[model samples]
Target: MSATQSYAHSRQQKLVVGFSQTPAPTTGLTRQEIRDLSLKGVKTRAASTAGSGRLHGKVAIITGAGPELAIGTGAARLFAREGAKHIYLLDYNPAPLSRLAEALREKYPNTKASPNPMRHSRSTVDQDGVLDLAVSALVDQAIQEEGHLDVFFANAGIIQRPPKRVGGGGDEIAEELRATGRNMGGIEDTEFMEVLRVNTLRWVEAGSNISYAFKSPIHARPWRAETLGIFGLSVFLGIKYASAAMAKTTSNKTKSVPGGSIILTASVAGLKANAGPIPYSASKAAVISLAQTTAYELAGSNIRVNAICPGLIETDMTRGAFEMARMAGKEGRMGVLNPLLRQGLGVEVAQMALFLASDDSSYVNGQALPVDGGLTASMPYIRPKL
Candidate 1:
């Protein structure tokens, strides 16, 4: 066999042996216990957890923090462990959010976790307006209880699939594209717009004229759309409310500082092509732009805005790809595009989030930092024997 094939074969053998198809009871632990231990090991080894009161007395909000293995959930747990006074978890799905909140409460008794469902039953107004009300209410509650807002992690997003077209020229083009495993051209107008709306704009409220008059090359535009059938919130609105809450002076603390950290979840796809679907990539690119622009707009206020661009992470969102690779015995091939030569876990991304959310990244602002294991550091090229 060739050197490449030999290496791949060796790796595959290791994977097969290292991870058993089923947990062996010889370890003297239940299946769930083993899973929990593995998770704890990953978190412990990923970074130092020496308690230093990094976020003591700080109130924070994290969206998309519902799933057990999601990046947002990892961040919420990290923040709680690091002494965050309160964490408000928001997600479209209430069941998972509530379960996550309960888990956090059990794991970290000192930290207060509130699971909030970002859903609205009212159809009287634009769906965006309903979201605006829901967000506003959450922020208000955080302020009323904690008296200060410290961190806002805008990590909620969706990887949209274009609906199958029928009986038209567009449908023909879509079929051709799908045959090649490309769906960008097949995406419908409404679906494309929905991705943009849910991924980029954070709708404040209907008929409310909010403007950013600061003279910078970047200009903020008013986004108005009838709530499409899809429902999800975006990062722009998080910045809008979080920044405002961060700027307020709280009576509980003397000599209060008007500054906080806002972390937006972007992706490696946003930084380069072929990393994700067109709409998802474009939306993430907009997120990076929002980070840069908002950092400037909120300048001198001590509120740092930045984006985290993750590469190949094994989360619920990307679990299908991982499962498929494993089923095909191509797990060793996963994440080979990155220098790490392995897939990253959500806790790994959570470490970066922790740094940004804490005072450690106080000087970092308006940057799109990639936690992609140096994938974007260079072009795709095979290593040469020296």
Candidate 2:
């Protein structure tokens, strides 16, 4: 069979296997019992048949699955629900990572899920050797286990804490400005450089090294040399490398899957000013641009590149913000600016990532899709005229 045909046939077999393993639905529960549970806001896993198995037979990798209610963990759960064959999860913290893997296994017994603890240091990002060793090892592990990688979710990220003086209160706006100033000083500040190195440059390094996994030869080596000289190691490198990886054909002709999808976790901060701290917002803005430009570069190669710009989602990263609102008895005001008038869940953002990963979004590319509940639609000062 031709490679394309083999790919289709393999996917069909995997889907059938998944369907056969689906657990039977509960039949004895009465309508009233179900309603009571629903009214109580009881959460349940999606039944295996809940979705159309959009990611059937696909191999996926999710980085930064740290917090229990994190985007990476949410994506992993959703991917399994959508019938991804194998998921390789990475996180800096071993405790939450293992728990996420266990949760996936219990929910989707037929799917293969593994947790890996990998930490990336500042030296890892700045030094080529360290970055290559870390990123290449991840790609290699995925390939070794599944034989091919269909989707990569670069969801790992860090946010500089708001200044202590700015503790979540009435002075939040002013305190936030102070925090931004402290984190993002003059362009030459070492602390500012550190934030850039972790948030931006590391992504570029990982994206570039991941391209090697697809057996792509860097024909324009001089471009890297020239651009590095000009841009001085910015987020552009990650986009450049990831695009190259996505655009290349499989070195092993026997492997059925060739081109794949990449999903970057940007933020609404990237779309509008003051949404986040200065350094973070700037890095995410770069990520948004990267998604758009790379999608254009890899147009015909069957590789789709996209980004998810999330709004105020509850996670470890936002614990402080959430906690302060709760303490002030103003939790309801958390996401009042958005039309939804409520904060979002991690699963909501993950659902968007699932769309981009699956064939459901095959025609969608180069888009910085916002899962922010219409928050990015207008200026913050535009009040509803009552």
lDDT of each: 0.72, 0.64
Q: Which one is best on TM-score?
A: 1
Candidate 1, residues 220-242: lDDT per residue as tens digits? Answer: 34233443232235687788878
lDDT of 2 by residue, 1-386 (tens): 55665665554444334332333257565433433343234135332237568898887767667477788778888898888888876556766766777778898887777554243211111112114354556556555555677887877776663345634455764554446555344334444445555555542332332232223432243334233422312234334444444443446553355578888888999999878877778778878887887677666777777989999987777876777777787665566456544577787788899989988888888889998878897544422245
Q: What's the C-alpha lDDT at position 56 in model 2?
A: 86
lDDT of 2 at 128: 27
Query: Mind sharing the TM-score for model 1?
Result: 0.75
Candidate 2 has a TM-score of 0.71
> What lDDT does candidate 2 reach at residue 150?
81
| Stretches of model 2 off by over 4 angstroms after superposition | 1-51, 117-131, 161-188, 203-219, 223-257, 382-386
Worst 10 residues of 1 by lDDT: 121-130
Clashing pairs in 2: 204-238
Q: Which sections of candidate 1 miss by over 4 Å? A: 1-50, 116-130, 162-181, 202-233, 381-386
